[model samples]
Target: MNNQSKQPISPTAHGHRLVVETLNTHPNALRRLHSPGSAENELSELIVHTALHLDTVQKELVDRCTWAAQDLTRVATGTAAPNSLGVLQNSGLQIDLLAARRADAKAHLRSALAAYQRVTTIAKPQHAGPHPPLPSRTSPRTR
Candidate 1:
């Protein structure tokens, strides 16, 4: 059997298992039997995976930031009223948590970008004639 017929990549981790399962289905369709561009297709799949992962991370970060902003707004609007000190303190703590989450998200994004760069650099498509272009990872590109 062709290596292209091999099983798809799947992560064993609980949440990732479902994602893995979804991605694994319909491999034959992804291979494009007529085209037979195995290497290029594989690279495209990787890029797609990276993009999705980054999107999820960014969404979570945005959600955290929004929640923090809402809490702050409530504190600002309500603190002038009676018995608001405890609520204000809780809101401050939540804002701090959101700030930390934002920082974490930024770090994760940087790491994801670095991983993408590494994949592009190390897996050269320079010689892939008649196939899709694989971004080079040999050197960092000027943004």
Candidate 2:
């Protein structure tokens, strides 16, 4: 048999076996692909969950702010009830809070993405073989 044709066991194969062993031994590995109970995976999942929740909240805040602005406009135009002023003011405060929360959530989402990227990068296999060279274009003169 040609040495080139007979390949050695791949690192990826070893990694697969290791993952299988880990899944068999770890209590929580069966619950999720990333091992939900593990610290790193759990943190990543939590961050994603929190980011999604924050996105929903941000959308709601935007709607509320729009409604509040419409109410305030009505108040200024003497179309809204006098008691609506207090509610509009409180809505302004809520809008400010939501803006701050959105900023924080974006930051957390970035951090979580970075953390997850690191984990995936670490798991990826590095190719050891030399890369194939690009095909050369034959010039008219050469042909």
Using lDDT as the measure, which candidate wins? 2
Q: State the local distance difference test value for candidate 1.
A: 0.49
Per-residue accuracy of model 2 over 1-143 as CA lDDT, tens digit each: 22322344233232222223322322223225465566557755655465455556567677788888788788789996657347767888889887787667666656655675576567668877998886666634543
Spell out the clash pairs found in candidate 2. Answer: none
| Counted clashes in each candidate structure | 3, 0
Q: How many backbone clashes does candidate 2 have?
A: 0
- TM of each candidate vs. truth: 0.37, 0.54
lDDT score, candidate 2? 0.56
Off by over 4 Å in 2: 1-44, 81-85, 128-143
Top candidate on TM-score is 2
Residue 3: error of model 2 in Å? 42
Compared with the true structure, all predictions reach lDDT values of 0.49, 0.56
Question: Stretches of candidate 1 above 4 Å error?
Answer: 1-82, 125-143
Worst 10 residues of 1 by lDDT: 11-20
Spell out the clash pairs found in candidate 1.
120-137, 121-137, 121-138
